[model samples]
Target: MTGNLTRAEQKQQTRNNIMAAALKKMSEDKGFSSLGLREVTKEAGIAPASFYRHFSNMEELGLALVSEAEDALQAILLDAKALEEKGEDIVASSVQVCMQHFRDNGPLFRVLAREATGNSPLIRRRIQRCLMNLNHQLAEIIELEMRRRHRKITNPLYIAEAISTLVFNLGIASADLPYAKQKEAEKRLAHHIRIIYWGAEAMANSQHLSRNIMLS
Candidate 1:
């Protein structure tokens, strides 16, 4: 069922296929630095020189893959956010979303998490941007909750950043560790979130009480 295509359309399709193959290979193996262009080209079933036509180098290709992974993760988390607003427990919904995402996209997450910490400035920066975006989204949610309660949020950004780090680490740890270890880790993570939320609520209440006392 081969259809006729314009030259540009065929070239674009080939490039997309190459990128897809490269992403798949990177997901399977965490060591992106060790991957050669020739190997990727072979896996992609394209000439080695053809790789250069799509990307300047393997690092460029890796950055593209990282971007794709970031988008996919954002989509999953956004869906979870929608669920949270519909009477779902926030922490439970978040954990479920993360677990499902990891189960479905383990390879992409593995590659990004493993290589983003290395010497590649581009990959590192892209990963950092993704983290920042996540933090911003969480901060907005926290601020919205605060507003709903008529509470002032003095450090929502910092709180969001901390929570974002916690969530990211939870995802990475759960994905990388053994099955038994992952279960234990998830329990610990849920407990940790509860403690954090409880402490914040207590602090907010104390602050309110102190303000009332001062007014009196």
Candidate 2:
């Protein structure tokens, strides 16, 4: 027997379908500036009037997509961060998780990459806010790690922001790469992130050493 959906469930399903259609249409080629409400609704197999029932405008739908993508990205990174708390390999695991996420959500990331460079001021600002949140979460994690190890970072936020920005900006290309090329790209990303972390660790340790020397 087919179960009928409640009004709220139907509304949510329609919203999800609209967002899915938008993501499917979004890519580096089209960019955010070109997406129209009618086109999205058409792709979603719904009437243009129905789209207004869900999102107020195309920008609102795009922002919702951005919010969803950012949440997924943050969750993947946070899961990796959780593993680090258990003494597991952090950088490699995080890179793997990122690659997996990109592979699974290539269209979404492509949309993000295009939107980041597109001509829409509103979309740009929304993306920036999303990045800021991701950076803040990473910064907090880094600060805790440094404190636990009795080290002092000059600017954990800077490091975290740089890393988060790099991932968001460069990860789009990985989604389009072939298997071998994707592997190479992920490896390079892992190495670069490891280098950044190690560099910060070295600086923090040097500060610790100098403070000890001064105290003695």
Candidate 3:
């Protein structure tokens, strides 16, 4: 006789498959609100009642999809961090990675951004938490770079928040724009990053000059 899997394990596997299928369908349509529970269950090859075993409703499923999108975006950022060791320009590498990620995962990002604005408290909170986590990660990197240059950062948190919001909004906005507008948006994003980097450098230099004068 063949050994059978446990009920919990099978349920989890089914849930995972449902989420995967739902994301695939959302990506194809680029509209989460239009996707119903029956559609997801049908796509997953499951009955309508089985969908409830995995998620309470489509809103809950949408929140889970936002987490998945955040994980995917974080992987790209981690890859950019690795590229920092390869003698590549950090800001340029970062922007390239971000743009590529938006291009690759536009559907997921668009769904999360659009649905989070609707009448779902759970989805809104999940999206906000993911953004906060991302901002913190970016802040850590900015702090590390400042320490590497022996620079004093007077307002690192503010700078990091500004950069994170700017980058995140750029990715969201680009996903909805036309091809020509997308190119212009990317250039504008790059310019914004460059301005932030230069301002940080100038602030560091001014601080150094002030310390030297005080010592003298």
Which candidate's TM-score is highest? 2
Residues 1-216, candidate 3: write the lDDT tens digits. Answer: 113868877887888788887877876754677788888889898999988878888878887788878887688668766765564666766776777788778767776667667567777888888877877777777767667656666566677788877876788778767888877887888899878877877887898899999999
Candidate 1 Cα outliers beyond 4 Å, as residue runs: 1-13, 24-30, 146-154, 176-186, 207-216
Q: Tens digit of lDDT per residue, candidate 2, span 151-182? A: 66668998897787677666777777888998
Q: lDDT of model 3 at residue 70?
A: 87
Q: Please, what is the TM-score per model?
A: 0.77, 0.85, 0.72
> Looking at model 3, which ten-residue stretch has the lowest summed lDDT?
1-10
> Clashes in model 2: which pairs?
none
lDDT, candidate 1, 1-216, per-residue tens: 126888788778877787777766776654778787887889889899988888988889888878878887787668766865675666666766666676667667766678768778888898888878877887777666666556654467777776667766677657767778877777777777666666667777788889999999
- Among all windows of 10 consecutive residues in model 2, the one with the lowest summed lDDT is 24-33
Which residue pairs clash in candidate 1? none
Clashes of 2: 0
Give the CA lDDT, 0 to 100, for residue 61 in model 3.
85
Off by over 4 Å in 2: 1-3, 149-152, 205-216
Query: Measured by TM-score, how close is model 1 to the native structure?
Result: 0.77
Model 1 Cα displacement at 199 (Å)?
2.5
